[model samples]
Structures are given as structure tokens and as C-alpha cells.
Target: MRIRPTSARGGLPPAAASAESPAALSGPDGRRLPASPRRRRPDLAALAVLLILGGTAATITLMLNGSARVSAIRITRQVTAGQPLSRAGMEEVRIAGTGIDYLPWSQHASYAQRLALVTLLPGTLLTTQMTATASEGITPGKARVGLALKPGQSPAELRAGQRVQIISLPRQDPGDRTTTVLAQSALVDAVSDPGTHGPPRLVNVIVDAALSPRIAAYASNGQIVLAYLPAAH
Candidate 1:
């Protein structure tokens, strides 16, 4: 039998022995494989936790940002529908909470002060533009009537659109002690200036169709005096 070098075993050379050592086996191209595939480090767990917590905090903050409240606005004057509103005439107002306040004013509200101005009350008229919507409740009408005064009669002698009690004496014949007082209401249609014949001051009055005849008869006599009625309650 031929004798090989003493260091050789099973036909492997000395160089192969050094390559089989643990350090060399752990190196690249080693048949024993490198560092057990380098276990994925567990240190990344804390970073994942931080990211999750941050996302949760952001979500909570976004949920708490909205609210509501009641508001008030002022009526500048006796506003009739179809009339324009002037800034000089109107003012801002505020209202107390009834129960909830939807769309509460921001920190930058224009009328933060002047809390004395409360909600609008009845008889407080608002301009058409001040109204929430364009639609209106008042209706317009025609059939214009005017008041005419005789010479030397003062305009004050005519009361526009008033209710009065009239006492007519029967033809002076004095029959049946016939003293009849007619009581009715009439609107002041119009009145003429004492000196002018061209046209009279116009007044608008609303009355029932039946009452129109009686009013026309009495008014034509030229002896009638007009009176104004107090506004209805």
C-alpha cells in the first residue's frame, strides 16, 4: 500500500481540515452554512407599538371638533316686505340657548358684544332682505280712494281710515224722532290738499263690499268728516 502524508485522512487534504473549522464554516461559501440565517431581530417590536399608539392618538383628536348653538338677529325698523335693508338701520343681536346651539359662532363672531340685543319680538318688522327667504305674507291691492276737503277746511279735519258713529237727522221733517246713528269703519283712501284740485292725497282702506255702498253715499255728501281708527290689536 502507498503511504500518503500522515495529516491526510479518508483522502481529504490538510487544507480541507482548516476549511471545516467552526469559524471558517460560518463564513461565506462554507459548506456548514452561515450564522443560522441570522435570526430576524426581535428589537423591532417596540417600534411597531409606537406607530400603532400614534395612529390611535390622531384618530381620537379628530373625533372631538364639532358643536352647535342658538343665535339672534335684530330688526332695524318696521320692515315691510319687498323693501331694501340699509346697514345704518339694522343691528346685530344675540339669543340665549333654548336647548341646543347648532353651528355656534366661532371665536371670531362679528357681534361678540352687545348681548342686550335679544331675539326679535312681535311688531318688530324686518326688511325683505333680512328675512330668511324671499317669499312674503303681505298682499298688494288697487281701488285707490282719495279724500277731498271743501274750502277753508283744514286737512286735520279728515281722519284717514277710521271707524266712527254717524247720527243722521231725517230730512228735518222730524218724523218718529227718527234719529239714526250709523256706526262703521272705513279706511282712509286718500285726501286732497285744501288748495289743490289736480289730485288729492291718497289713502288705502279695506272694507267689505256691502259697506262700500254706504261709505260712498255718505262721502259724496261733502259734509262728512273722516276719522282714523286705532290699529287693530
Candidate 2:
């Protein structure tokens, strides 16, 4: 019998079969594709843009969740030391909430930092207005004076008749290096807040006539720091 070619015999030859398969039809670069299959090219720019937008949204969300802003508060009526900052005493004078605008500037510390400086306890009622009035005499004594207490100060620790000491710290004098006693432990006799009615009562105390004049002079020139102390025996 004569040997016949496979294609002639209704079967493709080995070479013909190999050519029809996908591997044989591919290009030298390997990227070449047959008509039956295709590869898609991704848009790099579009993917990058999406990533940036997502990051921005996440940052904004974090800032919003971490910080909050509050409106400036005022004495709607009056407040006292040893008193709480009650809702009735203050109203959110302005509509404000925490956000980017509310954030403190870089020059100043955060709102939390300033808040730490607050010595007043919560719920402290404003006892008296700090004043710079003339002293009655010379010896150390307590006088009813005025104070401009900042908003959100606590006066709760204060009692009506509690004894308190007032002392002024010494500061550096540009002229001399010596530190002089600004004020020593002075006594506060009483405290009173009239509320919306009238002026709060000034702190009063008994002191020598000589010290009275000095107290008056100090109030006139420097700030008066009030301190609460234990009751006398």
C-alpha cells in the first residue's frame, strides 16, 4: 500500500495542526493575541485620581471626628466662684461647632492647652468682681473688691465665710535683680455673689492698720490673686 498524506486522507498533517493551535499563531513579542481573545489596557491616571480622592475624604473624616468647636460663652446673668458653669448662666451666644475654622492657630497652643490653664473649678459661682480700689489703711486686711472673672471659671470651692489667703508673686524688675515680696499670705474674710440682683460682696478680713494701706496699694497697681484656705480654729 502507498503511504498517503494525512490532510489528503481527511486528517490534518502534524505541521497543519500545530499552526492552527494558539501557541503557534502567537507573535514573537508574546503580546500578540489571536482574533478569538483580547487583552485590556488599564487607565493609570483614572486609578491614581480615585486613590487621591479617597485619601482626602478619609483625612477630612478623621479631623471632624477628632475635634469639635464651641461658641464663645458669656455671663448671661452672673456667675460666682465655687459655682458651676450652668446652662442657665451661659448660653451658646453663637452657633459654632468643632471644625477646621475652630482650630486654634499654630502660634497659639490648642484649645485644650488653654483650657489646662484654667484654675477655676467647674460650677464655681462668681463671688465678686475684682477691683483696683484704694485701701482703707496700712496693715494687711481684706476688702470687698471687684474682679473680672473670665467666662468658664469655677468658684465652687469658695464658701460664703471661708477664709482665704491672697498672695502676689514677685516678678523680675528690669532695674534691679533683687526679688521683692509682691504680696504675702493675706486673709479673705467673706465672699458674696448677689446674682442678677446687685454687685457681689467683696472679700473682707481683719488686719492691722499698717497692712491695710499696703493691700490697697497692691490692688491699685497689680493683680489680686485670691486663694481659699481652711477655716480658723
Provide the TM-score for each candidate, comma-separated.
0.32, 0.26
- Model 1 global lDDT (CA atoms, 0 to 1): 0.40
At residue 214, candidate 2 shows an lDDT of: 59
lDDT tens digits by residue: candidate 1, 1-233: 98655463565666766667666555446554346666785679888998999999988765543222234444444433222233343444454445533223332133221111123333343222233211121225422323343443223454332333333334434474564433344434334443445344333343445544554564455433444443322
Candidate no. 1 TM-score = 0.32
Residue runs of model 1 more than 4 Å from their true location after superposition: 1-146, 151-183, 195-204
Best-matching candidate per lDDT: 2
lDDT of 2 by residue, 1-233 (tens): 98756765577887887787668756665665456756665797789899999999999987875564344433343322212233344333333353324222221211111111112333322222211112322233333543322212214445333334554434346664443333343333344554433543345543445555655655455534456554211
Worst 10 residues of 2 by lDDT: 109-118
lDDT of residue 145 for candidate 2: 41
Query: In TM-score terms, which candidate is top?
Result: 1
Write down the worst ten-residue block by lDDT for model 1: 108-117
